[model samples]
Target: MVAITGSSSYNPIITINTTTTINEKLTPATFPQWRAQFEALLIGYDLIDFVTSKHQCLAIDGTKSATSKAVNFYWIRQDKLILHAILVSISTTITSFLTSCKTSHEAWAALTCLYKGKYRTRTMQLKEDLTLSTRSSRSVIEFLQAMKIIAYELAIIDHPISDDDLILYILNGLGPEFRDIAAPIRAKETSLKFEEIHDLLVGHENYIRRMENQLASNLITTVNYSHWKGGISSNDRSFSNMGHRHNKQAIHPKATPSSIQMNLQQIVQPPHKEKIKNGLLTLLHRTR
Candidate 1:
């Protein structure tokens, strides 16, 4: 196992490739090696513009004999993973909620927050906090609850959590003072968590709300109008349709006073040609 450290103190404790179980092969800019490179880069706190590759972690093919347990992709998922959590924040929507930073005071304050940073992506596991343990928990609810419990402790309530149901409902969340709080503490925790979660989430929902006023701002998302309007192909089709109609008036003379008085100059125009043009024009209009 190896360790990577940031140049400065502000960075989170990010550990990478801290294991000898590096089973896969490494490529210069390819899979396992690429991620190893990224781990190395993190040591200096340098921002990488793009991810170069994916690494392998497990192999599941029907390879050599008795047992078969494998994972094909080897990436930083283990390090990035916040997996194996027991409890977490409960929320209604994905994009609509804002999870707060995991802090030391959350458990004491009867509040909960997101364990990972906003820019981070992670997965969660569940716990036996009775409030959510027995009900039909959807994926989102289970996940939120697990994340909350991990970051903060919950106050224990007076309600009897029998020995048999200990596996089902938690007497208190995992933390230092969790076992001591009373049942009424549950209400306070629930209220604070709900309200703070709602408020923090609302902030994310309203992030830069009045976008209409930021037209000239550097952060504005601008798309080229000309690109959206399409190009010569679209314009040519429209012009071709109008051109067909315009040619008729240009070639055939109108029955105005001056037009009617004008001499033929040489040979008389063919009445059949004029009738043919007019007939074709009428046919086109009818078809349309």
Candidate 2:
């Protein structure tokens, strides 16, 4: 839990090392590899080591949130930190939440799929970072990103991020019956009285209504990610020039070419996690 500070031209950098405690917390019935990766991402880099300026930033990731006790270490970097302030689908992870992050409204059309619309407030999340800038430093893009971040991370509610047609499906599937449910009403706190029952009923109804909407929305998300799996974005122009939108339709029935490479860094690869498991097993076997 020790924090060390560093500085850069753009911002201040904070570093923390939680290896000792995190190693103790590692468990068998969990995503140990992901947890270890998170631990490394945290201790491996300086939490805060840059300037408190604009051009550059130095930040660290958090566990669920500053307050949440669950050691769900999050993946955060300067780029992801910017997700709610100024980002676009094409720009970077942070900017993707805002409308103005892209070059044109057309670009926004694609990025807009990430928006979570709870009727009045489209942001499915929120954020509180006093160090980055004043809350007053709000813009359409920043506003949206902040809102969605809060909603998804804090509320366990996510803004729908499917295609336009999927959005239309969500609206249609909601069937206008759930439209007037009034998010404020659902958000209101109820005591242990019958009011709680009433609120619960209302919540259940809304959830039931959302079932259809969610199903359709999920399909689009899957399709999008499926496309991404085939390698969607890359910096090399030559890669970009190869083709946009890896054609799912073009693959012949005869055979599937290309081994379908994956990011070895993520998912399957868990650093030396396997090695650790083997080492532990060896110790147990020798004792036996």
Candidate 3:
């Protein structure tokens, strides 16, 4: 453990335990997420100033005075503590990168340059991702989230995306389903925030689902009505057939013996010439 007092008025004296507090080890692969934690730990112990060379003691004169010796001792002790803390916070692989460095400041610079390259490479990748992003295969929510992540990464690398640009990207990448939502947003006098746009998209999605459900219900109802009408038409034809059969039975009365004899007499009998003359004479007398 080492106690270091900060020269800055706002920073208080801090005690750092190299064994416990510096347990988070960093490597080339894990440097991005681990950098913040390591830097915060250094700041907490008030030793970051030493690593940045902000707290170096002034060079003493060649005289062997007690005050000069004391100043040299204090400077050496503070520098050693900061260097040791940095060493303990990284893995052996990362330590190899700093082996030639003799001071904490040198090691800090080396690490910053190494990670800056990684950061630049990451920044380019995020830019490409943002450029190639589309909503064709993913939901609107998923597309928006991916764009936001890319924007955040770009901002981290000192290349922040503007709100207007973000909105345009969202609109351009969206599927045709979102055109209605995009139209109104684009027509607005002022641009909507990302949150506002998200809400509007969600609302539109719900509306589309409701419309689809209503259309499906209507189609089902139409099919059922047609089926019912067809059944009624079949029943009407059956009733008409029954009525025709009933009328035929009413006229014939099941062919009793009297009705059979009448039908045979009409078919077999022929009228005589005298009978015809008598029928004509009877009609003339009636007219007179």
Question: Cα deviation in Å at residue 210, candidate 3?
Answer: 2.8
Per residue, candidate 3 scores C-alpha lDDT tens digits across 166-211 of: 8888888886888888888888899688898888887887797677
Which window of 10 residues has the lowest lDDT sum in candidate 1?
82-91
What's the count of clashing pairs in each model shown? 22, 36, 0
Model 1 lDDT, full chain set = 0.30
Using Cα atoms with residue i matched to residue i, what is each candidate's TM-score against the true structure? 0.14, 0.15, 0.61
The numbered model that scores best in lDDT is 3
Q: Predictions ranked by TM-score, top down?
A: 3, 2, 1
On TM-score, the candidate that comes out on top is 3
* Native-to-model Cα distance after best TM-score fit, residue 117 in candidate 2, in Å: 25
Mark the regions of model 1 whose C-alpha exceeds 4 Å error after superposition.
Answer: 1-194, 208-224, 228-288
Would you list the C-alpha lDDT of every candidate in the order shown? 0.30, 0.33, 0.65
Candidates ranked by lDDT, best first?
3, 2, 1
Better of 2 and 3 by TM-score: 3
Q: What TM-score does structure 1 among the candidates reach? A: 0.14
lDDT of 3 at 144: 84
lDDT of 1 by residue, 177-267 (tens): 2233324344452233333443443343344233423422211111112223443244333433443343433212222322222321111
